[model samples]
Target: MNITVCNPLLRTPLSLIVDDSCPVINLTYYWIHQRHAWKARHQPNIAPERWEGDTIQLKKIPPTIPADFAWEWAEWCWENGVKGKFSLIPYPAGIGRVDEGFPDFPTREYQAWLRIYRELIWPSFDLTPEMLTHTAVVDLDTFTLTEAWEQVEWVDPPVDNRLTDYIIIAMEMLDNVGIPCEGVTSPGAFGKRQEAAYARAVLTASQHVNNNPRPFYFLWLKHDELPDVPIWYPDKEKGVAIASIVSCAGDWFGGWTGYDLGDADRFITEDLQGGCLPPILEKELPCVLVGHWPGFYFNGEKSGFEILKTVKARLDAYDPDGTKTLWMKNSEIGHYWMARELTKLTVMEEPPQIHLSTQFPTANFTLALDTPVRHIQVNGWDLREVHSRRDFQTDTFLVEGKQTFVAFDLEVGKTELELIVA
Candidate 1:
């Protein structure tokens, strides 16, 4: 019998990536100010004409998104079982520290924002810091803002300890505010120049703060092809690995400025025939969609939020009954890819048996075998076979055509399987 590893339950993976998000402050408002300052000091020719348009857009958007909106969004995601990554900027363009409190912002309101994040957002999302501040670069030694923009200046330098230190500081700030992070989110073009060093820094910082050996980061946005979760800085002996998970689709719901109303049909048409998601689903690849927090607000109209809902509805229509697609967080997708690449499998012909050795414990690990299975026992425990894909889950097997698919909870170290076939 020929045996092969398949996707988690043999379903296409889907996830969302939200950037430029923090607790209360409308990041764009402060973000624009910092960019203007940086432009004057460093690059004086950064589109001087667009400054007025930026300021005009800022006036239309609220200074803060407020905790009420956060609660509403969190509730919607929870009800829908939506899972993804959300960024929390520790300093937020040097406006204020999340742990301490933003200057001039009401203390009570700030506390409310933190509480909403801890109770609601934390449950369904992988929370990460979009670096220390999303604006001007920070001088690690002086703890002061430099004239250079973080996205521009930071990506220029080669891999060094400073990058690791910078990431650690951001993670620590979130930790102080009672939010534990498993990864870091890059701000704009941060670390895009030297990906190897950035990957190393993320792994080192995550290990130091969260003690997470298998970490992931979000950096690039790709559209032409299905994005891959590429592993970086793997140390088998030390049990450390990191993955760069890229988003597959652009922000079609709205722009980061919270002013541009994005088209939902760009992701998935109402007919469910066209859009970027269908091709990804057809290929059974991870369709990680990208969006921004400010855009979701849409200047308080929530147009972007509505667009997301529309896209999700279209996806369901395309893969109704949840048989073809699986919604997952970026971290979960990373882990699945890691297991797919690193886990070693051994098969035996006599009496039919299989053995698996994995460095990470993964859920819903699925395998397809060419021969029909009479029974399967993982470490002496018999697995119950399910008839339908909807019924298929961990410790369950399904038979289709010449292939018999088995899904189970894969543990760390080693697992022994006794495959009794006819």
Candidate 2:
């Protein structure tokens, strides 16, 4: 039910609007009276109906608070051990031919959906373990019970087009935080070879300005008609299979390719196009953004649902102790019917600390505190780079300095922390 704007800082809303096919009720947490975005936990913003040919409609609508609606639904969510601010709104839908009248409803009904949501439904639902954002893969090209989600003609599915959407969402989030960001979702290039140039321009423009080390979350969606990639299956026998390398993963593995149903080639192309996921896979992102458009959701899991549920499920379960509803990834319920809950199932240890100090802002800071550091090396934030290294702990005639980075591990809430000077 959350619509994302792009930016680095994370936001948890007390209220949100849910779009099933056309549009419907707004959801809210029982007025906690904390955030400004939410007006008194019970009230929400809603959008008014628009004309058929309108290209742009009112973006912001006040969520309506219904009379029959009660806080009782929250209890259902809470008692079931559900937690988090995500609203899991199930709608009746599947992909179908374009010629068919969409949503199978009248124009007035669209407004009616909104009415039922605000007046009767919204204030009554529970929270799911979903987050503000998540991830999933859509096999839109494959056959599924859901209706086909073909790309918009204008949405040429170009690299620039994909990049544009990602940037738009990111910039919107930034703007929300009062940071001015500007960019465009340009039309993609004509050929595959032009991608490198397009990607470079978009990225360079994003930089060459900001000095505060602002965050840039880049999401590269591959648009190859036959790009090779990994095939993940929920089935036990059908483990992960290599299809083709994705371009975003970099040229290290080589360019990617497509796959035939029975094609059992283990290794094929040199370029393993990898890292298409926004912010690029494994690249750390402080926050992720996603859209809550109706077409994006009713699309269904396993068919092409990652746009809605994937982000929702992971982000919702962000806090472990928090009780969020169990939303299965992709609505792709695993043999189980009830939507899955995503409590903080496991705790991941934070990477070891690596404090960077220099003799001077201009001094040549050289010296490897090479020690057996404990970590796999992930979070490479643009502003800070942390790493683990062992230094000589004075015992015997150690061939090293007398200190290591581990001694300066930061503890939570330790205000005015101390650091070693080089």
Candidate 3:
């Protein structure tokens, strides 16, 4: 009698192809410039003399304690393959106008702060105007703002150009300060309108300022009943394509509940592994986590900084070679994911080549193989020795190699590739 044994290794596909969804640290600036305002409101007696002169001098004002916290957090991101989206709210509260309580633009003090941002903060992170003052629209002349309740109402299916105007203003401010304002993230809440004016405003601003379309990374909570996918606003006439990505985690600051170093570990082992990875792997979506600077520095001890470092360590351990996990700033990830969605992918079995044609030629994609790859060719040209990882499954009867992972870039137009298995 003749018996045959099935090879589990043979049953697996020669290569596993999937899109990469990188993790992002979405840090918001709510109180970066609000300390004076908070003091005036709570302890009026000790507040700094209200600056009545047109020229406010902030050069003498030392960096806020929170600025150090921010620097420390950014340092960890730089060291560890982590990227961040820092929301820059130019005016906090009591720093700008007397009545309306907005910072005066072009003031010497304001310029000093901008210089600090350009020199110190801008290098490590991508900046977003978290909406001027992060509150209601203010009248420069009257020194009054729109109703507080109606401030962020533009988010509710914005139909008018109010949000667009705000975005343009914010972009102009960043440009004046020499900060590249590539995207926008809404403050917090919105109303019930279905038109999606906020997203349209972001795209319009990007085209007007940067002369290109860009994606918006919105603050999304886990409990929010929204799909974790790129949201595209359909406008075929002008050929505007923009997407909104929902954040995967709640605010790192104890918004729902304070998260510490241990919480950071749980976020990776439980929440990220169980909640984010499944959807990303199954649906090919980006997994972005959002947090606020105030939340992380709630205790003034830089706990959030530690949490960020711990999260990076966990991610590094999960993918030591850094081939499987893609770490990028939120804006970069948004643009890349949008490009991947728009691109067309085709795989050939005979030559074992993957073909990608995309408007975005520089987008990155990963290819996983069951057998060791000898070499890879792109567009019929030989690529330099590519990095790959080997996996193995052991059993009592046999120890078989599982898969090898490879990452490559796809250029615009037809990109032909060939993979030789060793």
lDDT of each: 0.84, 0.23, 0.48
Model 1 misplacement above 4 A: 41-53
Question: Which candidate, 1 or 2, would have the higher TM-score against the true structure?
Answer: 1
Worst 10 residues of 1 by lDDT: 47-56
Residues 335-417 of candidate 3 have per-residue lDDT tens digits of 55555555566777776776666665333354445555567666666655522223312111111254444444545567676
What is candidate 3's local distance difference test score?
A: 0.48
Candidate 2 C-alpha lDDT tens digits along 1-422? 11111111111111111211112222211111112222223245632222111112112222222211222323333344322112222211221121122254454534444444344433332112111111111223442322111111222334654433433333333333333332222211122244343344333434432221111112233433222222112122211111111222221110110000111011111122222322222232211112222222211111112222333333343433332122211111111111011101121223234333211111111122333322222123122223311221111111124422221211112112122223
Q: Model 1 clash pairs?
A: none
**Residues 1-422, candidate 1, lDDT per residue (tens digit)?**
78898989988888888898897798887787667665676667765456223765666877788888888988898888788899998999887889889878888779888988888988888899999888888888898988766787787654778888989999999989777797889988799998888988898899899889998999999887667889887665555789888998968877788887789888988988788888788888889989999889887899999998988888888878888888888888888888887888899889789998888667888999998888999989999988899888889999887789998888888898998885
TM-score of each: 0.96, 0.23, 0.66
Candidate 3 clashes: the total is: 6
Candidate 2 root-mean-square deviation in Å: 20.7
Error of 3 at 150 (Å): 6.4
| Residue pairs with backbone overlap in model 3 | 96-102, 96-103, 97-102, 156-191, 157-193, 253-295
List candidate 2 segments past 4 Å from native. Answer: 1-179, 182-192, 207-219, 222-294, 297-422
The model with the greatest TM-score is: 1
Model 2 lDDT at residue 368: 28
